[model samples]
Target chain A: MLSIQNLHVQVEEKEILKGINLEVKPGELHVIMGRNGTGKSTLANVLAGRDKYTVPQGNITFNNESLLDKTPEDRACSGLFLSFQYPVAIPGVNNMYFLKAAVNAIRKSRGQDEMDAIDFLAMVREKLKEVALDESFIHRPVNDGFSGGEKKRNEILQMITLEPQLSILDETDSGLDIDALKIVAQGVNDYRSPERSFILITHYQRILNYMQPDFVHVLMNGKLVKSGTMELANELEEKGYSWIEKELTAAD
Target chain B: MENEIIKKSIAEEYKYGFETKVAQDTFPPGLDEGVIRALSDIKGEPEWLLEWRLKAYHHWLNMKEPTWAKVHYPPIDYQSISYYSAPKKKTLNSLDEVDPEILDTYNKLGIPLDEQKMLAGVAVDAVFDSVSVATTFKDTLKKAGVIFCSFSEAVKDHPELVQKYLGSVVPYTDNFYATLNSAVFSDGSFVYIPKGVRCPMELSTYFRINAANTGQFERTLIVADEGSHVSYLEGCTAPMRDENQLHAAVVELVALGNAEIKYSTVQNWYPGDKEGKGGIYNFVTKRGACRGDKSKISWTQVETGSAITWKYPSCILQGNDSVGEFYSVALTNNFQQADTGTKMIHLGKNTKSTIISKGISAGKGQQTYRGEVKIMKSAENSRNFSQCDSILIGDECGAHTFPYIDVRNSTAQMEHEATTSNIGEDQLFYCNQRGISTEDAVSLIVNGFCKEVFKELPMEFAVEAQKLMEVSLEGAVG
Candidate 1:
């Protein structure tokens, strides 16, 4: 569903993602684990068309279309979604209103009729139950005064409602408690279909126990040095990332 | 490139700038006691009212125009402006007698005057430039012991009430511009709700500046007697002109014991072109006095236009336990400058006041909120809460807050909070990533920021204010 080849991304004149390559087939879940400052977020932002990052050398193809020329909105309309680590608090825009605008905008781009308020609200309430978010959240400001857990759960509600072809969950499990992690994992498991793909970027392996990834890749110093299955995640969780760093240094 | 996008976004054309073609009855360009007497004679005002106008004219002659506001504009030449200009038309005894051309103009402006005249009981007093053209629901209002008519009609028919309440709240000598307005004021609305009676319907007045180069100085007065209640709304619009038109108006509200008066204004005067060539210099003085114990007054205004706007609709809480509120949303875009706020004067025991102001400046527009809250020594246990917030869309605009608070009574409690911030890049990106356009995103964020003040507007005015904000800030960001 997504392909990245020799992606060299720079922010503030310094390349963060150096010569990185990855690919994920439809319905596959890819987990990219890395330490701090090792380009896990850089890869996610570059894929979602954030304007601050400049790509000098690389090409990204999503669903057989090049993403380099697309705007953030265009990329969003094309079923590419990025769940930010920290969502901004848009205080005056109601959560439900923002969701309707987003949903209608994407629908319009795909030649679909706009959803009326009554039908949209009914659908949104059902999705909110999947993520354990209260129905009252529809009236509140978007993430304004929300706890970290509530913000993540709202993100899951959005993902469930939009039903995007590909979703990049950036540190989705970092702020969740044990029960919230299980609920969030349940939401993802429920939404999974043969046509949907997910790229889970995280620093901790604790959430991996709840949701299984088809492929686990260890990212070190802007490059993926290891790729394997579920057992490799257990191996790294037992040993930590230092062993992988030392092995990379020995190989160099 | 970034600057270009911001500039393109704020270059929205003024859609209501079309001129209305009508033969004008304009006075010669000048200002003096003679001109004031001529104005009084034209309106057939009483002798005592003529003397009152002369007194205000003498006072205005000695006072200098204030330049202390945080706005810069070219000096206004009072001698060059014609103080009175009205469309030449015969007296209309009924709606059917009204001119078709004038009716079409209001219809095109989307004013509900025609629709209300056709249907139910919304009393409307339509003021065009220097005259009160048509007042609807006249007999219905009279049956309820409510005197709703033009200022001229009130002066002729109900001279005692007009003489009693005119300038009672904001006296003629109150300020520089108000003094001039009192002297040469042509026509506006006059509403009086009698004791123990609630007005049956909302009272509305629409002011339109259809004449070019003619200054608009209208006076509005409303008196709510003991145990009475009324909700009054005022709205204004002007045609586009090359020369700046001056508008100095005074509004006074009097609420007696246990009476409540709610006054709302949606002001959309012509705010000059992209470079701010020509628009109205809107200097208005509006104040309501809570005279009797337990009286309440609320002023809600949405100021969205004018090249330079200087207004402060205030409330004087002189009655024990009286309450006052000022809710305003002032938005300026593309070279407009506005310095507006409100005043709360607490003079009685246990009086309270609340002020919520939201100022939005986009493009090169500059907005300032200047508010004052005063608690006298006798105003024991009075409380005041003031919140002022500002949002700047582009880089060049400015927002300033000046809150002057004085509390002589130690028992009085006062709270003030102010905030100023730019549109965050992250907020825009977040919206953009959700497939929303940048312009729509800006509007969403700004509307959220102004939700507090918008809630105070009447239903239709709230929708108009929101759309006005969107038009003012459209394409102001990349």
Candidate 2:
């Protein structure tokens, strides 16, 4: 469903991602683990069509179409979702209203009619249950005054509500507690289907204990150095990323 | 690329810019005692009113236009602006006798003059240029002991009420522009709710400036008697002109014991072109007086147009336990500049006031929120709470706040909060990633920022205000 070929990205005239290549098929889950400043979040943002990052080399394709010229909204309407590392706090916009706008905008782009308020509310309530958020959240401003765990759970709630074809979860589990992490993973697991895929970008391996992944890759210096199964995640958890850096140095 | 889009959006044309073609009785461009006398004579005013106009005219000659506001414009050529311009229709006993061109103009502005086609609960008084052309639901209002008519009609038919309440809140000698407005003010609306009677419907006045090179000076006075209630609304718009047209209006409101008066305004005058060539110079004075114990007054305004807007609708809480409230949403785009807020003067014991102001600046627009809350020594145990917030859309725009607070009574409690923020790229990207367009995102964020003030508006006006915000911030994303 998604392909990235030797993608090179830069921000503020400094290269952040150099010659990174990745591929994911339908229904597959890919976990990219890296330390700080290793371009894990950069790859997720570049895929979501954030304009601040410039792509100077190679290409990225989604559903067999080049995504370089598509706007962020266009990319979103084409079934791409990015769970931001830090959710923005829109002070007075109700979460329900914002979600309805998003849902209707995507539905309109797909040549479908808008979802009525009644039906949308019903769907949102059900999705809230999956993320363990109560009805009070719908009335509050979008992410304003939300705790770290609540924000992560809200991202997962959005992922469930949008039902995107490919979702990039950028550090969604970084600040979550054990209970919140399980709830977020449960929401993701319940929403997974044969035609949906996810790229979970995180700095910890704790969340992997709740949800299984098809592939685990270690990202270092903007490149995917190693790719393996869940056992590699367990190995990295037992020994931190420093061992991987030592291995890369010995290989060089 | 983003800057180009922002420029394109801010360049959106003013929608209410079409002129009305009508034969007008316009005075030649000049301002003097003779012109004021001629204006009063043309209106067939009583001798006392004419003398009052002369008094205000003499006072205006001594007063200089104040320039402390954070706005820049060339000096106004007061001598070059015609003081009076009205459609040449002499007398109108009914809507049938009104000029079709004037009626067509109002109809095109979405205000149907015919009673049956108007909004269900809104009684409208349509003022064209310098005269009140038509007033609807007069008989219905009269049956409820409510006197709703033009200022001139009130002067002729209900002179006692007019003389009692006119200038009671904001006198003719209030300020420079107000003094000028009093001298040659042509026509506006007057509403009076009798003692213990609640107004049955919404009272609204629509002011339209159609004539070229003419200044529009209208006076509006509303009085809510003891135990009465009323909701009044004012709307204004002007045709596009090459030279800046002047609009100086004065509105005074009075609420007696247990009376509640709600005043709302949606000001959408022509805000000039992209380069700010021509538009309305709106300098208005609006004030309300709580004259008896337990009286309440609220001022809600949504201002989105005019090349330069200088207004501060104020309230004087003179009655013990009286309440005053001000809610405003001012949006400035293109080259528009607005310096507006409200003032609350607490003069009675246990009086309270609340102010919520929201300002949005886009393009090269500049906006300021200047508010004042004063608690006098006599206002023992008074309280005031104020919140002022501003949001800037583009890099070139500016937002400023100047809040003046003076509390002489130690028992008084005052709270003030202010914030300034930009529509950051991250917020826009977050909305875009959710499948919403940048334009829609801008509207959403701005409407959210203005939610507090918009909630204070009437339902219909609230919806119109939201749509106006969307139009004003059309492509303001950066």
Candidate 3:
């Protein structure tokens, strides 16, 4: 349901992503393992249509529709969700208000009727259970003053609320304790459906214990250098990224 | 795309920009002894009251315009401004006698001048230009022994109370603007809550400036008698104009023994144009005096307009064990400028005060929060706390804080905290990536920033304040 081809992205006159290619089919969870500065986060941001990240050459398509031309909000309305690694604190906007605006915006784009406050609250309360959030959490400002784990769980709650067609988790596993990782992973597993797809961008394979992925890819030096099955994640966990670096050097 | 959005936002016009067509009889231009005497005569003031105006006029002449505020504006020509303009229609003894055209003005302003149709709990006194056109729900107020009417009407009907308390809190010569307002002030509302009687409803005054080239100087006074309580609301809005108009107002409050007064304001005067062509230069003085033991006074304001706003609503806690509170949310967008805050003067023993102020600046707007807390030698054991926060939406805008504290008594306690934050690009990107537009994101951030002060406003005004904030930042971010 998501495709990226020849993705060359730069930030601040420095190339961060060099000719990367990725593809994910419906109901598939593709884990992209990479070290810091390897452009995995840049790929997620570019896919979510963030500015200041220049895509010099490449094309991304979601559900067979071009995503390169859409604004960040438009891309989100098109069912592309990116769970930020660091959820920015929006001090005044309540989490519930933010979600309602997002939900209505997406619904408007999709020509669906807006949800009433009662229904919205009911739905949000139901989803909060999956992420272990309480009722008060929705009324608080978006991620303001939240702990790292709470932010990740809040992001997961948003994912559950929005129910996007293509979800990209940008190192959401970081800063999360083991318990939080499991809850977050449980949220993702609960949200999974045959019509939805996921791009799990992470550095470690610890979270893989909670939710299994269909494929694994290693990103290094701004490109995907290796592809394999779940066994690759175990191998990388045991051998470390140095093995992939040695293999790349040998191939070069 | 960014520039296109900026241009569109810069072109954003005032929503309350429409002028009402009415036949107006304006006083001759220029401020002099004759002008003050004529205004006094029009109100049929007592000889002593007229003498007070003359004294204020002389004091105003000697006082120079205060340029110390963190705002920039051209020198005001006092003589070029016409002091008064009133609807030519005869004074209405009742709602039926009120001219339909005049009622139409307030109607378009979302304020139904018809008393019976007004919000059940609010008694609105509609002030149009130089006159108080209508004061609604008088019968209900009268039943509660509350005297609510125009300042001019009070001069004729309740002369004793008006004379006893006029300028008692904020003297005529208190400051430059207060002196000018005292000299030729038009009509504003006067409210009196009798001893031991809580006001039956929220007393509100809606001030509108309709006449051109005429300055609107309204005087409001509210006295809460012993053991009484009252909440007062004042809202101001002006039509869009190319030539800058002037608004200098004086508001005074006196709370007697065990009494409490809560005064709120939502000032939305036209903030000129994007290039700062035309708007109101708002210079206002508002103060409350806790005159008796255990008295209390609180002021909450939402200011989001005016080309230049220079106002400080202060409280003088003069009674033993008195309390004072100030909560404000001041926003400036486009070419608007505002330097607004509060002053808490502790004069009585064991008095206490709290101040919370929020300032938001967007586009080319400049905002400043100037506050003061003073503890006198007599006010031993007095306590005070002040918090000032500012949020800037764009880099081109500015936010500033100036806080002054003076304590003569070693036993007094005072605390101050200030913080500055910006609606960063990352924050907006985060919201946008989640399906919210930039405009909605700005509003959310700003509303969150002002949530503390907004909770202090009355429910209806709080909703309107949020909407006003959103409207002010229409073109602020892209």
Query: In candidate 1 chain B, what residue range of length 10 has the lowest lDDT sum?
Result: B112-121
Candidate 3: fraction of native contacts reproduced: 0.92
- Which has the higher lDDT value, candidate number 1 or candidate number 3? 3
lDDT of 1 by residue, B405-457 (tens): 98899999999999998888788888888888888898999898889888887
Model 2, B390: alpha-carbon shift in Å? Answer: 0.5
Q: Is candidate 2 or candidate 3 better by lDDT?
A: 2
The regions of model 3 sitting more than 4 angstroms off are B1-8
The runs of at least 3 residues in candidate 1 whose Cα sits more than 4 Å from the true structure, single-residue gaps closed, are B1-4, B115-121
Poorest lDDT segment (10 consecutive residues) of candidate 3 chain B: B1-10
Kindly list the per-residue Cα lDDT of model 2 for residues B256-310, writing each as its tens digit: 9999999999999999998899999999999999989999999999999899999
Residue lDDT tens for model 1, A149-236: 8888888888888878999999999978999999988998998888899999998889988887999999887889899988888888
What fraction of the correct interface contacts does each predicted structure contain? 0.80, 0.83, 0.92
| TM-score of decoy 1 | 0.98
DockQ of 1: 0.75
Ranking by TM-score: 2, 3, 1
Winning candidate number (lDDT): 2
Better of 1 and 3 by DockQ: 3
DockQ of each: 0.75, 0.81, 0.77
